[model samples]
Target: MSLTWAPALERPDLLAEPVRHALEAMASDGADVAAVEVTEIDPDHADTAVLVEATGWDLRDMANCIVISGARAGEERVCAALVLGHTRADVNKAVRKRLDVRKCSFMPMDEAVGRSGMEYGGITPVGVPSGWPVLVDARVVQREHIVIGSGLRRSKLRLPGALAARLPGAEVVEDLALEPPT
Candidate 1:
């Protein structure tokens, strides 16, 4: 099915201003990012799982996962990471190692909502705080196109993987793994 904007993927009208600003900024940068509504699933759900059960597109050559979490107050601003969809973000070890923090944790729902300005389930990489770090898996660059969040849960954006790597603040890394979830 062709991808198009659907009401189900739109964020609530009450979204915080920062999130809206982020979207506008991305647009100003000539990114083809757009808001879309997708089926409401847990934000923590694996992208590979969504691809298999929802899109039915094998991600063997296209996309990888980008899991993000916020740092503790007075610590790094935010922690954005990339991992293969077949695997989970190495929150305890790899991620922590990279951040050089003694501890790291997922952003709380309320904090995420406040800081990201997007609803918990609807956060999209396209429209996030400008200073926030955007990590990408190097493997994703091999694919000409890939799918990612559209700043809402009910929708996803399909774009060139290379562009994703070039998004402002994005950093490509080679630490991603393909291990299956436990």
Candidate 2:
């Protein structure tokens, strides 16, 4: 379906380099996905809350990609956790248990941006480090298509939710996020 929200990923200018590269790689392997850049926003204000309000997008159609790390002695093991914007990742319970670690927390902003090679507030699951799991909430894939960060604050990705489920080292976990109180 042609999307009125954003244009095709055929033009590299429409997406961040990393995101375009990731999408190109996916397309080369025959995965279908698309992305678009949103004009008139300060990159520093690209967090989910800001983007959602700025673009007038439905919260349920969007998900936040957060880099989280587990406690380890020598080296930290980090994973990209994707959860619906309306809910929060279950870091203390679900994530810690899933990672099999005593404690887990959101990666420091500097480290997350540095290691992921993506801008802060614009981290996406497409090009995460190899072997790092992309834990996607089950609710995410149930949607036909969803919006995600583009590894750059200027743009966003619209793609089949199942594509996230198929990303490298992806783990589709139930209740990865805890819903907010009604």
Candidate 3:
């Protein structure tokens, strides 16, 4: 089925507060963002499927999907989003390099939930903490629109690709991926 924007698809009962907040924030900024619900799949599993479907030039392309989790810095917690599938956030190398952290890792589940104020699977790139850095893959902008997480595993959000790059504290960058370990 084709994708379409519809608020009714948001599944409010399952919508994560951070995602809700992000959507509201984007709306306040004059962006037209909407959410759609679909079957849930583990990010790893989904990655494989996404790759199989992305033939031709699309394989190298980036899609805007939010993967929210708490990043650990000693006892501190930070929420983050990275573009989907083919690209890795370079969390260990590039992201840490960019953030100037000696070491970095995905936020622990509990910390991610606490900081984001949203359930683990429900986090979206939209309503994350104001100061949290948003890293967008430069390749994602090539698409006119993108489908990102809606703060919930069962749903996805659709919005202008450019708006994602404009999110507060977001920094658009190129070469966000690292070659998978051989």
Name the candidate that leads on TM-score.
Answer: 2
TM-score of each: 0.67, 0.87, 0.68
Q: How much is the lDDT of residue 48 in candidate 1? A: 49
lDDT of 3 at 112: 65
| CA RMSD per model (angstroms) | 5.1, 3.1, 4.9
Tens-digit lDDT string for candidate 1 (4-26): 43332154342334444654566
TM-score pick, better of 2 and 3 = 2
**Pairs in steric clash, model 1:** 9-37, 9-38, 37-154, 37-155, 38-154, 38-155
Residues 1-182, candidate 3: write the lDDT tens digits: 33334662355544566666655676677765543233343443234345235322244333533433333465443436556446667666666666656666776667666666755555556667776777777766666666555565555555566776777667777766554577
Per-prediction count of colliding residue pairs? 6, 0, 7
Tell me how far the alpha carbon of residue 162 in candidate 3 is from the true structure, in angstroms, after superposition. Answer: 1.8
Minimal lDDT window, size 10, model 1: 7-16
- Order the candidates by lDDT, highest first: 2, 3, 1
Residue-by-residue lDDT tens digits, candidate 2, 123-176: 998788787899999999897777887777766677777777977778999999
